[model samples]
Target: MTWSSMLLLAVTVERVGELWFARRNTKALLSKGGREIGKEHYSLIVALHTLWLSSLWVVAWNVRVHPIWLGVFVCLQALRFWTLATLGKRWTTRIIVVPGETLVAAGPYRFIRHPNYLVVIGEIAVFPLCLGQPLHALVFSIANALVLTVRIKTENAALSGSRHV
Candidate 1:
């Protein structure tokens, strides 16, 4: 495998690990009476991410990695880890709000209402660019924006009645 392919493989493994962690968190949240909102659009989000990653593997396999872009991607991962760590066990792939729970106001959440989404937005674009696939970056970025439009609205509505951040 080429270097780009190896990087993609590492990313793929990281994503699978995240999915496993999210699943465990989701189960725990649901068990604690956290009801999920916007279930209908969840599959679209999953499909978009899956296709984005899969397409990169197909089109960027032979491409050379861009050092600067890879650096940006690394920074994004750091932000991602911060967001996840801030949320801790409350972090799930889906919007599941536990009633009576206050929104987390620590870490990145202190500044951005949706820090995780911001990180994802960057990733959707930067991952491709780092692999020397700018066109792929643009295409997936647009798709992700469309999906996130609906997602953010749903999330906001779900948390609207809850305690303030």
Candidate 2:
């Protein structure tokens, strides 16, 4: 495997680890009375993400990597880590709302409502571009936008109804 493939492989492994961590966090939060919204679309979201990453290897395994796009993707990972660190225990791949908890305004949250979503958007698009696949990036970006449209609305409603604003 080339250096770029190795990078992507490492990331794929990291994503699996994240899923495990998120599940653990989500379980803990739920045990503490966390109310999970958007359950209806949760499966779809999982499938989309799972397929997305898998498709990356299938489609871009041998494609020449674009260094510029990869660099942007690396920057996005920094932002992703920042957002995750800010949320700490509250962060999860799924929308699990802890009732009565105030909105987090620290870290990247201070400047934007959905900083993690921005990272998600960037990853979905940028990673494909990094592998020189514009069609993958474009198609997945549109799909992600559609999914986030529902997720954001669901999350906003839940948050607005609870203590968080």
Q: Which predicted model would earn the best lDDT?
A: 1
Tens digits of per-residue lDDT for model 2 on 13-120? 889888988999999999999978899988878988888888988877877889999899999999999998999888898888776678888899889999999999
Say which candidate scores most in TM-score.
1
* Model 1: residues with Cα > 4 Å off, grouped in runs: none
Model 1 gets an lDDT of 0.94
TM-scores of the candidates are 0.97, 0.95
The CA lDDT of each predicted structure is 0.94, 0.88
- In the range 36-144, model 1's lDDT, one tens digit per residue, is 9999999999999999999888888888999999999999999999999999999999999998899899999889899999999999999999988888889989999
* C-alpha lDDT (0 to 100) for residue 141 of candidate 2: 92
CA deviation > 4 Å runs, candidate 2 = none
Q: Which residue pairs does candidate 2 place in steric collision?
A: none
Query: What is the alpha-carbon lDDT for the whole of candidate 2?
Result: 0.88
